[model samples]
Target: MNLSCGIIGKPFSGKSTLFALMTGEDGGGKFGPVRGMAKVSDSRIDYLSSLYHPKKTTYASVEFIDVPGVSGSETGENKMLEHVRNTESLLAVIGAFEEEDCDASLQGEIQGILDELLLNDLILTENRLEKIKHQRNPQEKDEFVLFSRLHEALEENRPLRSLDLKEDEQKAIKGFQFFTLKPLMFVINIHEEAIPRAEAIENRLREKLANDAHTGVIALSALIEEEIMQLPEEERPAFLEEMGIGEPATEKVIRSIYSLLGLISFFTAGEDEVKAWTIRKGASARSAAGEIHSDIERGFIKAELVHYDDFAATPDMKKLKEAGLVRLEGKEYVVRDGDIINFKFNV
Candidate 1:
C-alpha cells in the first residue's frame, strides 16, 4: 500500500524541522507543501536481508507531506486542509518547550487544531445534509442518516472516528474524507535540554488527549533528530547511544503511525529479493497476496507461513520445519505482523 501522512501545525511549531528529519528532505527554503518518503526501519527486514543476502532489499515506507504552516485566516486554513484531506493520516507538531504556560498552552494548541478539523467537517456534513434533504433515493436516504449522525457528533464537539460505524457505513462516506475520521498523532516538539524528561513530557501531554479516540501523543526534540541526521551513517548509532536516546525519534514516529493507522507488515524473503509488504490489520491471506500482485491473489491456494520470531530463533529453514514452526494457512487466514509468507499460487 502507498500510505501517506501529512505533517501539520501552527507556524513555528517545528513541523518543518520534524519533516526534514523524518524524510531527510530540507524543505526549509521551499514553498507550499513538500513530499518525501521515510522508510520504516524494521529489524526483521534487516535480519532477513542479512540471512538471505538478497540482491535487492526493500523496506516498507510511508510518504510524509510537509504542509505549509496553518494560519488564522480562513483561506490559509482551507488551503492547508486541502493539502492534507487525501492523506491517510496526520501528525500535528506542537512546540512545547518555550511556552510560558507550557501545559495549558499545549492543551490550547491541540484543541485549536481539533476545533478547526471539527468545524470544517461540520460545514461539509451540514451542507451535504441540506442538499440531500429534498432527495428521495435509497442511496441518498442512507447518506442522510449517516450525515445526520455525523452532524450531531460534530456539533457536540465529537470526532467522526469516535463513532462505532460498521464496515459498510465507513465505505459509504469514504469519499467525504472527513479530517476528524483520520488517524492523528500529536508530536510534541521539545528542546534538547528536555531530553532526559521526554517520558514525563509525553505522559503529561497524553493526558490531555486521553479521551480522544484514534489519537496518539509522543514527544521528541527535533533539534536532536537534526543532529542525528547530519551525522555520518556509521557514527549515528554511537551518537544516539551517547545522547542516551534508545531509538531515533523518526523510527518512533513511524512505528506510532503504523499503530495509529492499524497497519502491519508481512515479508517475502529470497535470494533475489527480501522485502516488507504493508497491509491493513486483520487483512486476510488473499488480501495480503494482492499486495504483491493481483494474479497471486486471484490464483492463491494457501500460504506457507513462519513467524519472524520463530525464524530468528532457529535461523535454519529445515530446523524450523522440523520443529513444526512452519505452517500452511488458507486464504481466509489473517496475516500477522512480522509473518514471513510464501504464497502457493498458479495463474
Candidate 2:
C-alpha cells in the first residue's frame, strides 16, 4: 500500500508531461526527481461517504517519483539507477507520436529500454560473479554456482525478472536488486489521432508486454491530457463525455499501477470518518489491521465484515443486522476489494 513507483524514460520522451498529468501538477523546473502523492480514485469511497455523511473522508494514495531522463552519461545513468532502485515499480514513458521520420516506434522504444535494463543487470552480475569465482572458500563456491547460472540467463538476453527462484534462492540475491527484476508498467504516449488504435496497439504488444505477471501496457496521449487539464473544472466532465473517455490519464495510470502491483482497497465508514485503505490482494485480516495501527493488530480478536454490495443494499446498520449480512471473520480471512470491515480489538 505504501508502494512508490519511479517514472523513467529517455530524453525527449513525454515522461515529464505524463508525470504532470498524473500528479495534477506542473513538472517543477528543477534538476532532481519530482515527487507527488496521487489519489487512488474509488467510487466506493464516494458511496460510503454519501451514506455515512462522515465528518472527514479520505482516499488511498500512492507516491510517484519522476526520475530525470537517463542517456549518454554514465553518471546520469547511475543517478537514475539509484532512484529506480528505491521504487517498488517502474513506469517507462515512450514517445510514440508519428513524425516525418517516425524513428521512435513504440515497439522499438520498449525494446531499447529493456536492452538497457538487461545490460545494467548483466554488468553487475558479471562483476559479482567474478569476485565470487576468485575466492577459493567452499561458501563462496556455492554463490559462484548460483550467480553463474544467472550469468547464463543474462547472456541469453533473458532478464532476471523471468526467473522463478525458490524462496531460499530469492533470499540469496535479493540484496542485489537487479534493475531487470523490478515490475514494469509501460506508457506509450501516442499521438492524439492514434487514440482509437490504443486497444489494437496493446493487443499487438501483448506478448512482449507480458514481461511478467506484474507487467502491463497502456497507450495514452499526453497532448490530450494536457489540453483537458487546461479546461475549467466544471467543463471537463462534459469534454471527457464528448470524447468518450471513461477515465483521465491520471486515473488510468493509477488503475494500471494498482493492477500491476496487485493492490486492493477496503473501506471503513462511519459518522466520524469514511476511509479507504489499501492492501495487497491476498492480505489477511490481521495484516490489514496492522496497516491501520500496531495496537489494533496486536489485540486483534475478530473482524466485523460485510461486502460493500450488501451494505449498499441495506445501508443502515440496523437493516444489515436484520438481514444477517454482516459476519464476524477471524484473522485468517483474506480481505477483498470493496469489503467493509471493523476490527474488534481491546488494547
Candidate 3:
C-alpha cells in the first residue's frame, strides 16, 4: 500500500512554500491539493545499487499531499480536515515568519491546531454514534461497541492515537480510519532572523511534547528552503553550512515521519535491478514477498537472505556464499532493517 502524508496549515502560513521546496514543484494554491512523491533515501540501497550496478534502481517512497491552506471560513477548514482524515500522517506547519506572525504566541498556535484536530475527530465520533444507534443489526460485528468507546474518548478531548486498542478490537474497527489515530509532526516555519534560535525552539517543543507517541517537532526557515531551491545544486551545500543548518528541513521531517510510522526498508538485489521495499518494522518474510509480488508470496518458498552489512563488508556474492553469510529462511522469519532477500518461489 502507498502511504500518504497530508500537509496542512493556515493560509499564508508558509505551508505551500514549504511544500514547493520539499517537492520541487508547485503545490496547489489556497484551495486545492497537490500530490507529490518523495523518494526515501537509504544508504544501504545506494551501496547495493553500486554493488549490483543494475539497469534499474528503485527507492521506497512516501506520497505527500499539500492540502489547501485552511482558513477562518468553515468551508476551507472542512476541506483541510477532509484531506487530513485521508492521510497516514499529518504535517502541521506553524508560521513563525515575521510577515505572517499575526499570532504572537507560537505555543498557542500549536494548541489551536491540536484543538481543531480533536474537534474534527470528535465530530466524526458523534456522527458515527448516530449512525450506529440506528443500525439494523443489533450484533453488527461489535463495531457499535467499538465506536461507542471511541466516542467517549473523543468527548474527553483525547486523540484516538493514544488509545491502546487490542488486536481483536483493532480488527473490529479496522475500516474506520480515524484522523486522531494518525501520527503528527509539527513544522515550525521561522524567518531567517530566528534561524539561530530554531534549535532552541524545537528543543522546547520537544520537551513539551515529549510524552506524546508518534509525534515530532521540528523548526526550519522556509525562506531558506525557498532560496535553496533557486540556487545551483553545487552551491547549496556551502550555503547550508553558512546558515548553520546540517540538512534540509524536508529531510529531517521525512526522517521523523519514518520513525513515527514504524516503517523500515529491506532490499532485493540482482543483475537486473536493485530495489528497496518498505514494510512495518516487525513484518515477516511472507509479507515482504507480497510487497514484491503476490505470486511469489503464494508460492511460499524459503527466502535466501543476507544482512546488508555482511554483503557490504564482503563485496562479493561468491565469497559471501562461501563464508555462509547468506542464509535461508521460512516465510515466518521476521525481516530486519537491512535485509537483502531473494525470494525462492515457483509458479
TM-score, per-candidate, Cα-based: 0.96, 0.90, 0.92
Residue 318 in model 2: lDDT: 77
RMSD versus native structure for model 1: 1.4
Best by lDDT: 1
Give lDDT per model, in order: 0.89, 0.82, 0.83
Tell me which of candidates 2 and 3 scores higher on lDDT.
3
Model 3 pairs whose backbones collide: none
Model 3 stretches with alpha carbons more than 4 Å out: 99-104, 134-138
Tens digit of per-residue lDDT, candidate 2, span 72-112 = 44467766767767677788888787843133366777888
Report the lDDT of model 2 for residue 21.
78
Please tell me which model should have the higher lDDT, number 1 or number 3. 1
Candidate 1 — which pairs collide? none
Off by over 4 Å in 1: 28-31, 73-75, 99-101
* Span of 10 residues, lowest total lDDT, candidate 1: 22-31
For residue 67, what is the lDDT in candidate 1?
79
